[model samples]
Target: MARSDDAIAGSAERTRSVRLALASLSLSMLLPSLSTSIANVALPTLAQEFSASFQQVQWIVLAYLLAITTVIVSVGRLGDLIGRRRLLLAGLLLFTGASTLCGLAPTLWLLIGARAIQGLGAAIMMALTMAFVGETVPKEKTGSAMGLLGTMSAVGTALGPSLGGLFIAGPGWPAIFFVNLPVGLLTFVLAYRYLPADRKGAKTDRARFDNVGTLLLALTLAAYSLSMTLGRGSFGGLNVALLLAAVFGVGLFAFAEAKAASPLMQLAMFRNPALSAGFAMSTLVTTVVMATLVVGPFYLSGALALDAARVGLVMSVGPVVAALTGVPAGRMVDRFGAHGMTVAGLLAAAIGSAILPMVPAQLGIPGYVGPLALITAGYALFQAANNTSVMADIVPERRGLVSGMLNLSRNLGLITGASVMGAVFAFGSGASDITSAKPDAVVSGMQLTFAVAAALIVVALAIALVSRAVSRGVASTEPGAGA
Candidate 1:
């Protein structure tokens, strides 16, 4: 009876630690996404304060994103080599300190520089949070953890614009960043107290960090991200040149990785059909989601004749739905299994996108919102399922690397969607400039863009199907075979 009592007490203690670890992880997921959306809303105000052009002010946002995109994979690998717990605590500290710098900077350039540093910190947080799940949470509950992270991420993204607007209206732009201090400190403490210490004598402990490969991949990702980001609505000669450079960088990276003593990302991982398919589908789906972001505002304001407030309100539905659905979607992933949930999520998204262009203009906000909500819910479902599928069975040593790749894929998709999807909307609208386009042109562009989004989802579905088939074949061929 005494032993039984001790066992129950131990279980209760572990549960408490797990909760603390998850809280830290959730905050880690939230900060970067919140930072992204919140800063975007403050760009106009920042331009006024700094006396900078749209291009100059845009860098405040771009610097953070670019920093994250470039270093996420490297930091993930670093966490694997060194230790996720220590690195994550360092990240939280860096993020909090950088946020203070962002609030205190007097000049625009200083702010941009600070944002870049903040982005690096955010990169560590984003890369390692998911990686921590396997260590912190039980195997049966991985889906729940993934869902919780997804929910926090979506909440941060959804909450940002409104929160930033309030800060800007009251305490001013600095508070947008200053808000991170309390949250960051709490997250850091929880993590320090609850997270597992780095394991010693592990196989990865002896592996050297691949400096050369890291540099090559950083340059490659930087070039690609710039190509997709710079010039925004207009793809110019610089964009083309940057894109070409990125292509070359990819080749160089591949060569460097092949020759490295310890590659940052194993070249052999791509051979796994399911893993490859997960990356591809994640990229494709995020691109579609970005289409909604890039295109939805224009349609709401122009085609639906909504005011700025109304447009924002309507736009919030997507992320709000995503946040609300995250936990349930995760539960579904646990109940239905990641593979099936992934398929179901994709199908639902495809159907939602397919139905969107057909939504009557007369139905107004409801027409637009209903379909948008469905798409976002599907996205929430897919993210939880896909992440679980990838991370659930991964070896402990490789979790950080794999998590980083997942995040990298997502960031790449958003960047591509912002650029490519915007171009598609403009072209489909037959407008020289989207912001000033006529209502009918805006409507046409929206339809065409969503049509393209549906097509992309279909492609993702096809890949998922093929991955499933391949997995079955591989399993059937293993020792003892189908028997």
Candidate 2:
């Protein structure tokens, strides 16, 4: 009787510990996702305050994206080598410090610089968050655990524009960054108290840090990101040089990885059809989603003459829907597998994109909100399922590398989406002043942008379908596969 009672108490204690760990990780995850979208709402205000051009203002977001993309893989591997918990704590501290710097920056350049540092910290945290979840949760419940994380991410991302609008309207843009302080401190305390320490003599304890691969990868991403952004806005000798540099960097990185004792990313991982397809589809979906996000605020304010608060409110709808649906979508993935959900989700997004352009001019914000919500719902379904599929084939030991790769895909999508969509808007509208652009021109530009986004998602959908078929075919061919 005493032993039974003790067993019950121990089980209850473990359950409590698990809940605390999830809460701490979720809070930590929220910070980076929130930061990603918060600045989108504040971009116009920052541009006006600094008297900056569209190109210059874009660097505010691009700097952070670039930093994360460049360093994410290396940081993920580092976490594997050292410990995810230790890296997560260090990342939170760095992110918190950088947030403070961002709020205090006196000039545009300084703000951009501070944002880059914040991105570095975000890279570390983002890369390790999934691995930490994988470590803490039981294998059977991984889908549910990932679902909760996805829900928190959706909530944070969705709240960004609305929260930013509120802050910008009252205490101003700096308040957004300042708000992170309290949240960060609280999260730090919870994390320090709840997260487990690294095991003694872990596998990666003797593993070498791939410094050469790290430097090469960083250079590769830097060149590619800069080239894409620059080429979109301007076509000149500098752009040409950057593009060539990007190609050269990729070749060198590939060569280094092939020869290295410990590669930052194992090239052989791409041979797994599901993992490769998942990553590619993730990048494509995020590209369109982020492009729409970047364009939405400008469309509301510039074309429709909506106030910042209204714009924020309108943008919040999609994320809210996504947050609400993300967990259920994840559960569906666990039961039904990721393939069908992914295809359906992409179809929904494509439909939404197709309808966005046709939204009547007279209907105002209501017309946009419906389509946006549909798109976000699709994204929520797609991301949750796709994330599970990508990680399904990966071994536990390699979760850190795969997690980094996942985030790297996202940052790359963000970079491409922002730069490409911004350029399309600029060229199509032919308006130097975004805030004062004519409504007809802005509408036309928006239509073109969405059309392009729709086409890209279709391509992703086709890829996903083909991959699923191939997977099924392979499985059937294996001896006694079902048994």
Give Cα-based local distance difference scores for all models: 0.93, 0.84
**Candidate 1 residue lDDT tens string, 1-483:** 999999999999999999998998999999999999999999999999999999999999999999999999999988888888888899999999999999999999999999999999999999999999999988888888999999999999999999999999999999999999999999999999999998884334535898888998899899999999888779999999999999999999999889888888889999888889999999999999999999999999989999999999989999899999999998888888999999999998999999999987888998998889889989999999999998877888888889999999999999999999999999999999888989889989999999999999999999999999998999899999957
Runs in model 1 lying further than 4 Å from the true structure: 202-207
lDDT of 2 by residue, 352-395 (tens): 99899889767898889888888988888888778877877677
**TM-score, model 1 to reference:** 0.98
* Model 2 weakest lDDT span, ten residues long: 198-207
The prediction achieving the highest lDDT against the true structure is: 1
RMSD of each: 1.2, 3.0
Pairs with backbone N, CA or C atoms under 3 Å apart (clashes), candidate 1: none
The alpha-carbon root-mean-square deviation between model 1 and the true structure, to one decimal in Å, is: 1.2
lDDT of 1 at 353: 95
